[model samples]
Target: MLAGAPSSHMSSSVSTSQGIFPTSRIGSGESPNSGASSFTQPIADMNENDETDLLSISWNQDYGCFAAGTSHGFRIYNCEPCKETFRRDLKSGGFKIVEMLFRCNILALVGAVANSHYPPNKVLIWDDHQSRCIGEFTFRSDVRGVKLRRDRIVVVLEHKIYVYNFTDLKLLHQIETLANPRGLCCLSHHSNTFVLACPGLHKGHVRVEHFGLNVTKLINAHDSQIACFTLTLDGLLLATASVKGTLIRIFNTMDGSRLQEVRRGVDRAEINSIALSPNVQWLAASSDRGTVHVFSLRVRVSGEDSLTQPNAFQGPALFHQNSSSSLDPLISPNTGANPNSSLSFMRGVLPKYFSSEWSFAQFHLPEYTHFIVAFGSQNSVIIVGMDGSFYRCSFDQVHGGEVVQQEYVRFLKFENRPK
Candidate 1:
């Protein structure tokens, strides 16, 4: 039996000082960093009876549901009810699921064996409610990621991204990349630019392009593996978490400059997941130590537009300047005429830490938070823990519109997005 009831709370406090940069600091800020924050109570929790590792998860925005892919198959949960709505209903294939995603109402599940030596490849699409396999695709090589675009379904494989037309599943494009790629993120909001991440033995690099043809920016960002990452909806901010250490770095998505580095989970444990709120005002990270941390972020919008140097926060500052001599031409060149150099101008575009005070709320889970995601347009958070537990919690947001009123207004407006 689980020892604790497994509850989660939101506790936050914002404090501003002249600024002290601890080598092991978990969070940072700029001048005039007036912190503000709020918290919420744990709403509900559900458990899946799995002993193996839980791998991937996808949130069904329209249906108010979420699904988690585990070592064997996959488990489905209803975020509204905070319970396991279904278990391993459609995953009958022999391979283990590595990734899962939901577009509209359709669910996609992908997985591969690590040491099997065989090209780890399997794809299955299941009906959400019926929990039945509606479609399946098996490839020769392992699949890295599955990205759903309004116009296409992108499948990331070894060094290549296969783009299939969403309407017909016909191959439309194939993007080639550096060998042994690790991360993939779609930059749809910025003129079809897709961000590709690949970390080497000693450093990390990110590329921005579309159809795998155009190379916009390539910069080395990290030292070890990038554990979890996300880009803001506007493609202005990019957040990356490290697996080698408990550090989260916020970068200017435009040029890949370090904006703020958060060290909160470094000593606690490895962070397994990170979520960027829809408004880009908050960030949530799930740690291996059975805790989910919520941070408030308020971007310092500077009025200056000069390009001589990268724009920085308007408040107290803490900079991570590696020996200026060791910087790479990709990050800092000798001539300074590098177009990529000024890319740091996007630094102050996204909020990193809350302007108000906030504290980390600990959730003693039946297990650790394996994967977590926050819902769009809602103040809801969903966490899937290692002990097969799935928890849902809602926070108090005064700025969030009233649900009853917004729904009525939306229903009455009858305005279509754009035909």
Candidate 2:
């Protein structure tokens, strides 16, 4: 959770949010050297022309900061005080994607923004301390996603994945994929080791490559098609969701063992994103149905074949603890009380909705918006939308009741985004 998050209260009405940076772009007046701000000072009478279309959002929990790509530039904000720490108006047409290198000043940018310093088809590595583009790499096709790890750069293209040496920008290896439109690829690094996972040669299968392409583990995770998948930081485990969207399966990356499964709901819905917490204790999922769910997980880390007992909260931890005693069922259909109650399942199912996983802590959004979910610094849930609205809310382990969410930040006012 962000340090300064206000004490929990039922604040249902989201208030208007003013811009963090003025209209003329950061260089015009809001330079980093600007004097300290006072709370008594009212925002410099706002303006609509000051705000730009927010194209992408990236947050770093380590430093409690996040970055946003706008129509004309990119801006970084500190999470605690919600202050803008860095801003650059490339004057490039626009930035569609901005990938921050954790808390460091290093970042990668690619998108509609095409300029002498940056281009739409290329990823420019920027060092904020220097306030200049340091290194960049271009792709044959439009670049979709860029993942920067300790020593390598992973770039995702429509039908291909590229890995590059971070220091010299040398092309290390490339892997072919099966028409991944969103450019989904995840890299997990730990203890000086790395593993990369993306869609395999087949539709619903997943391929895991350890370090280079020397050793790869292929797991037939689902039947329908992969919606999304995320790996534990150490790359020892992977969680996958298929287009069926109802059930989520966790796999051991080393040997492709199906450890455990969690149910979102029996209703068929589009799964947006799935995140595994640092300790592998919590799993969060978001869907097109306008809800986010967090599930408590239990993993036996003693042995490689140790079973994972998904501790789905129905009433309390005491009741679900018994599920771990037996290894008979790897995936249980009994994700009770938490989500997709039998009644809704009968409806979204017979009516042909995809099954979904129940989040231990579920939050809602306005309908028909594209959103991505992640865990914040303090087990707080962060959900961001493609329309430029983001939220931060923590789950109450005590009540296990309705979740109250506070609006954290807004990049685009409802009226400002182009229709």
Candidate 3:
């Protein structure tokens, strides 16, 4: 039987007129208290030269919100209602990366190279409640990315990742990886299962660290460099895509076994982001080809059962045993089964293309811009583009075809500079 696709009800359009702070203090650098307020300066009214350039965007631990680092400062937005929660315009400089710790006032910030006050080689731990950086970690090299949990902060450098204790900023551990210019790394947010995934020492390999179990497993995910990958909330499953960008593979993180594979397309493209549904029953991928593909996942990771078991965190048996047997028959409800070529039954007789599993549903965007995708409430997929476009689209889990665009908002609009 096909597991039910998760669903969420989101507003179809975001109201630009609504603001989280007083208009007079929009960019005044004053910290506004949390409460109701009027709309401030809309991006549309800002002068072309004064417009803040978007440097980076990332979703919080849960997909409930996302942070946007800009040339001037950083802002946070709520996902469901699609509203700007708050923003800080710092005079010191702009941030190249802004990572939020859930919905709290704490954020991990990396500055753009142009800013002298906040350099590229340092990570600032900002506490909005205090409106100042409480801690900072300076590195010898430019930081690539930052991941934050309540108890720890993981800073990704070009070839080394540093794990630090969140409270005292003490160095806890370090992992050497391949030359990872992108600073690719992911951490599980669940308290019971502390897992981390990053590129292995060798090309096309992934190093999985189960902190709770004190175990580390290496999986050779692909033949090409890993372009993008995402882990489930509990870190029980991993989905990886290589630079080839045509195929995506799902794996059981505990045993380093491939669970299922889904094809994005035959042509090569850069995969920007891969997101797995909270329930682990669906997967989504976005690419430079301007397409977002949703695939129904066949394997299930029993994350819930592990939470209730007494022996859950015992040695290497932390993960539920059901994960290995979760790969049920491919038969789905309305769709009957995952889409495959008619010659799929002739497996060995034909090429791999005929036997490959393709995406169940797809959504297209403008090919020129880069967009990242994440699964949202109620079977909807949330897409954020580099050009300041935000989209929320829903898909049919059973039929698997075109996704319906329910909401679209240009959260950041820049006027064309005078030539």
Question: How well does candidate 1 score on lDDT at residue 28?
Answer: 14
Error of model 3, residue 199, in angstroms: 0.1
- Candidate 3 lDDT: 0.76
> What's the residue-level lDDT of 311 in candidate 1?
16
* Cα-based lDDT at residue 76, candidate 3: 81
Q: Which stretches of candidate 2 lie over 4 Å from their true place?
A: 1-49, 61-63, 113-117, 302-357, 414-419
TM-score of each: 0.55, 0.73, 0.84
| Residue ranges of candidate 3 with Cα displaced over 4 Å | 1-50, 303-336, 417-419
Error of 2 at 56 (Å): 1.7
Model 1 clashing-pair count: 23
Top-TM-score candidate index: 3
Best by lDDT: 3
Ranking by TM-score: 3, 2, 1
The TM-score obtained by model 2 is: 0.73
When sorted by lDDT, best at the front, the candidate numbers are: 3, 2, 1
Tell how far residue 297 is off in model 2, in angstroms: 1.2
Clashing pairs in 3: 7-377, 7-378, 7-379, 8-377, 8-378
Q: What is the C-alpha lDDT of each candidate?
A: 0.44, 0.63, 0.76
